[model samples]
Target: MSWKTVLNEIKSSDGVLEVVDARCPNEFRSKRLEELFNEWEKPFWIIINKVDIVPKAFADRSKKFLKENSDAVDVVHVSSKKFYGFWILRRSLKSYFRDNKAKLVVVGFPNVGKSSLINMLAQCTVVSTAPVPGHTKGKQWIRISSKLLLSDTPGVIPKEFASRDWAKILFPDDVEESAFILLEKIKNAEGSNFEELYGFSPEPSEETLERIALKFRFLKKGGEPDTNRAATKLLNDWNNCKLTAWWL
Candidate 1:
């Protein structure tokens, strides 16, 4: 679903005190999910999952951004892989729902640990988690506590040019716009060096994009770089910040 649809649902839910974002640190920025949360007139918390997988640099930057944009918003870092920080997140939820008896919706992209975070919060395997994309295909509600109910929704890609808009939101007011652009450009330019550094030497004459796929081992059944599959793999990895330390 789009963030707009999610917001509309929250608005009509009759007093959801907090909106929880259960996305990886990089996705919270790349998809501009945090900006959507900050725009919310209602109180909310950012519950970032898969903390274990994200680099420390990204986590620190994300925390700083969360601290600055909205006082009502707090960032919660948790790793389902390591099962850490759920207690702190629960405390935040308890505080948000205190005396309000309101619902908290957990939203994020697919496979960003939304289901796992919800299951962990509910203290049961109430939600399903899988390694493949589009696992949580529908919405489910789980009660986190007596005063709080959490609604989990499937992941979505924004309909209109999500990537560029998201990049703008993520780098807002930093006064380093050109620097960010340059860095991204440099990363793409150094793709081959990265492959070699990782102990792989792809043919330079081959398609550069295909080289990326081959370097990452996203091969076809015929042991070739399936360009379509490579694109999908790269896009997913880029979204999840598996490409580089400063991937987001």
Candidate 2:
């Protein structure tokens, strides 16, 4: 699916469009989501979640870029980590709902923090939230109030979103890459560090994997962690995020 496809999906709906882009900064940037904003003739709001994980400098820059991208857009920073910006998002719901008090559809790439946002606003754990992708398979409609109806859909990867370069830059390509990044940064760490890094714990210890790769002679002659192969496996896993279990 192309970015245009997402736009078309929203346009096709009868309700007012409140395009919820739940993807992280990296995924958002890799797809050049801002370009979509520039291409859109209509105005939209951006509720960028996981802000606590993203640096303030980056967030500030993204806000500026988003604002400049569209006249009708407002970018808000949120981190479902602490349930920040939920009220701001609820208040921002006005621009789309208007006097019609119509249904508002929330759409974005899978695992982009949509369910968590909904749970916060509804004050009920009606929807599931996980770090892995492709968790939601069908349409799930949630009513926030008499005036507001929120609908959730399965994560759909746009056909035009085929840039591997973009993908790697945004999300960690796989568990290995995530593990390696976390491990390399560890002054002194454990499974919890890796768990927090990728949002999941591996069945085999990451260190065990590293040792196994070495035992199998997968390492380069240069004595590196064979991160290249490790990153490749991880990217594949991440790209096909449906294989992973949802965070329950």
Candidate 3:
């Protein structure tokens, strides 16, 4: 779906839930969306999804940071897979609006678990889900409660990211380059366990890719390390949530 369609959905809803990955909430959260919410005079809550993957302390700190840094009505940490934090989320919305009926729209970048959160909220698979980005292709309204409705929108990046490397990394044309970018972020991010995840420290360099290739025995016909294949594996691990990192 287009940004114009997403904006229309936001304008029509009573509020918005900006879902983000708890592992790296800061990187995933969109300031442009928040600004748009503010401009529209719409109340928004930041839903930090996949909190099960991060330490409670980290999640708490992230929530605190977002609460202090953004204009969201509330910052909620949740694990849609574990069905965690939905009670608080529901209560927060009802408490804020002081009504039994509400219409909330869920919005976020690709692969941040927007669809999964809606499924958990609705207590079933109301929309298709996959680990890949852009799994949700359109908008759908789901009745999550007797008087509450939630609209699930296709994930979108801000228009400002049109020329950014992170945007390119999302639907990358070069897997090796994308892996390198992700590796650099992980290397610099707090609480990253390079040795624990890969059995060796990472340098965010070509040599690191070679090491990953050799360790995984991803070799070419001439027995050379297949860095491209190694890069693919690294990206797969990231998308599968096998790799973990968080930033304060």
Q: What is the TM-score of each candidate against the true structure?
A: 0.59, 0.53, 0.88
Residue 67 displacement (Å), model 1: 0.8
**Number of backbone collisions per candidate, in order?**
0, 6, 0
Positional deviation of 242 in candidate 3, in angstroms?
0.8
Shift of residue 74 alpha carbon in model 1, Å: 1.1
Better of 1 and 2 by lDDT: 1
Off by over 4 Å in 1: 1-5, 14-40, 109-112, 123-140, 154-157, 164-207, 210-229, 236-244
Score residue 128 of candidate 3 by CA lDDT.
30
Query: Which residues of candidate 2, in runs, are more than 4 Å off?
Result: 1-9, 14-43, 124-139, 167-248
Task: Give the range of the ten consecutive residues with the poorest summed lDDT in model 3.
Answer: 126-135
Task: Report the C-alpha lDDT of model 1 over 155-184, residue by residue, as the tens digit.
Answer: 443434334534442333332342233234
lDDT of each: 0.51, 0.49, 0.80
Measured over all alpha carbons after superposition, the RMSD of each candidate to the real structure, in angstroms, is 8.9, 9.8, 5.0
Residue pairs whose backbone atoms clash in candidate 2: 1-158, 1-159, 26-170, 173-234, 173-235, 174-234
Q: Write the per-residue lDDT of candidate 2 for residues 1-248, one digit (tens) a residue.
A: 45555566555443322333322343343234445544544344566766555446656776676667544346677766577886676567665566555445454554556656666655533343222234245445565555555555423445346355334323654656454543342323221223443444454346645654564456878886675565555444433332221110
Q: Which candidate comes out best when scored by TM-score?
A: 3
Could you give candidate 3's per-residue lDDT for residues 1-248 as a string of tens digits? Answer: 68887888788788999898998888787887889899999999999999998889999998999999999999998899999988888778878878557778888888788878887886753433323234345435566555567765544656354336566556677989988888888888887666797898767789989999999999999999999999998888777677888786
Give per-residue lDDT, candidate 3, residue 162.
39
* Winner of 2 and 3 under lDDT: 3
